[model samples]
Target chain A: MPAETTRAANRERLAARRAAEAAARAQAERRRRTVLGGVVAAVAVLVALVAVIVVQTHRTSTSANAAVPANTVDGTVISVGSADAPVTVDLYEDFQCPNCKAFEDASGRTVAQLVADGTVQAHYHGMAFLDTSANGRYSTRALNAAAVVVATAGPGAFQAFHDLLFANQPVEGGSGLTDAQLVQYATQAGAAGSSVEHDIRNLTYGDWVKTATDQASKDGVTATPTVFVDGHKLADLSSAGLTSAVTAAAAG
Target chain B: MRWNAATAGPWLGTAARLVLGGVFVVAGALKVPDPGAAVRAVRAYRLLPESLVAPVAFGLPVIEIAVGLALLLGVFVRTASIAAAVLLVVFLVGVGSAWARGLRIDCGCFGNGGEVTAGETAYPLEVLRDAALVVVALLLARWPASRLALGGRSVAGTTDRKEYSRAR
Candidate 1:
């Protein structure tokens, strides 16, 4: 009887130990799954946050680009000097570019003096690379419209519009000149009638602006204020360099 | 978990090792030439914050080289395979995000800056490719093509042959 009892006790002890081990393993597995689920949830939240940030940044960039005013210019292309001039200088520039404005402020007067004296013919074509986001309020549209006004209303309007654009080059990526502001500039430049208003609403000069940009690209111009004198490239568009190039081109 | 040379098929294991090794070597080589460009490319994705960009850009190539070498040499084959699989998963996620956003930028994977349309660059295809690699990596991790490896031989010699033979 005692032997049978001892055998039964041993069997019971083995069964209990097995049951305890199984429960321990089950608890461990549950803990592991919980930890893994928490980790996955955390990672998912992190990924979502990153996605939101990226989208917001892209949205801001696009909206900012879209906010700049459109152009409102009119006119026919005109030669800046007499046809008998020795050198022809073509300057492709964006008004919003500081460098372009600087080139104009520094070398513009000298070029004008030369042109007035019949030593050179300066043909200016305004390009619009910085029209997207660089010029906060003034876009390619506004610049192109201004070009049309200069073409129609004459050199006085072009020069006035040019000075105004340079003076109003917004702090990088900010809203550029509004449509109303552009009309004010045109009025100041002696542009008459509803021409500026008409061009702004109709986007009349968009094709011309695109063609000018394409021409600039074909000419191997990448940056702003690219000055080409009689098909010869100058290293810098500064007064000294431009004057020297024009003098050389005139002599050649 | 006794391992033996006889348990893993030599031909299959060697092929997997060569393929995985070639992939890493090619990827690493493509990125090694212009580290700065690679950094810029990653930044353009705008996935990683500015803070994490430098570290990831600098360390990624080195890790890829190490993983490639380890896979080719068959040293730490299992660990290397796991690491490669994890990297592929991360890459898939990034590519998937760009595709979802309708971005028309290059994958910049090989660092050539070749742009592709969002429609052309599908997230599922990238995920499928990575998944295929993951399968191969899992196989390598499980079977461990160690017959030709120095570590494999040492491990096989020390382990009980009878137990592994039965398990295989």
Candidate 2:
């Protein structure tokens, strides 16, 4: 009987050791799998991040090299009105923005009046931040066309083209306008030369639009139709507000 | 024929995996097309430095897509789930900080995010959504076993609730 009991005890100890070894083996396998998974995830994330960075860098640099039109003041702004005007008004506007269109409707004449009276100099910095909203980048294309007008047809044509764009501003979240319509508008706005057509179709001034938009953001121009009167942000973007701001700045 | 954790957990995990996977993929895809807009949205947060914004804008969508694909394919569910939870927590913090700072901005969870009008900020809803997603992600992390998964058998077997008990 004692020998039988001893045999049973030995069997119990052997089974316990086997179970422990099995668990240990399972744990080691799990740890290996986890490490493998971690390696896979890390490699994927790193490769993806590097690829995006390279692509983004290429995109920005290519656009950065795009030629800035000769007429832009300091390589980004299109200056309108007398150079000696007492007040400086900087307008940051995106062609695809409805708010920008509304701002134009509200203060377009006031701006024209101020410019004509030689009381203010208007610097228009066109932005294409809304390019994503429209198919084929209406904001960038329209702004590029405006820049083309400035370069080929001078400030007068640019001013006319600018007004025409906002006046016929396409509804947001759709293709804003066709290149054909832009060309027609340019013609009606008195823009001449075949370069206007070539540039508008090819987005010759696309780089300038991107540069101007980036500059606007750096200059704290967050939203569209942002108006700065004598370097101060005009909070109220109304006709009266613009006029009063201009009058006060001119008075100073 | 009773529905219990062992019987029902995997199906629930599968549904969560698909939902989170779809959300991340769509979110990343929407922002990937317009990196500039994504950059602008990040800038609107006013949290990251100017230099870091572009890198974050470019890198984030890629990470989201990779993680999303991993989740959707059910390959490495635990790892993907943990990554997803981390991302959701980060978003929840971003939304919460924006709310606390009184900065009226969009969460930019999808594509069109930036400073919105004062009346347009949806901080509470964004925070709630992100927080809930974070919970779902953590739950998936805890129980990685989901039906129809491709490569999570070993990973899930280790943490699958009933499996753990049965194994013991």
lDDT winner among the candidates? 2
Q: What local lDDT does model 2 show for residue A241?
A: 95
Cα RMSDs, all models: 16.2, 3.8
Q: Candidate 2 lDDT, tens digit per residue, A1-252?
A: 999999999999999999999999988997798688779778978987899887876666544357888787988889999999999999988888888888899899899999999999999988786665436788889999998888887888899999999899888878779999999899888886687899899988877777777777666555666789999989899999999898898888
Residue pairs whose backbone atoms clash in candidate 2 = none
| Candidate 2 residue A224 C-alpha distance from true site, Å | 1.4
Alpha-carbon DockQ of candidate 2: 0.38
Candidate 2, chain A: TM-score? Answer: 0.94
Candidate 1 local lDDT, residue A230: 93
| Top-DockQ structure, candidate number | 2
TM-score of structure candidate 1: 0.44
- Clash counts for all predictions: 21, 0
Q: State the weakest 10-residue window (summed lDDT) of model 2 chain A.
A: A57-66
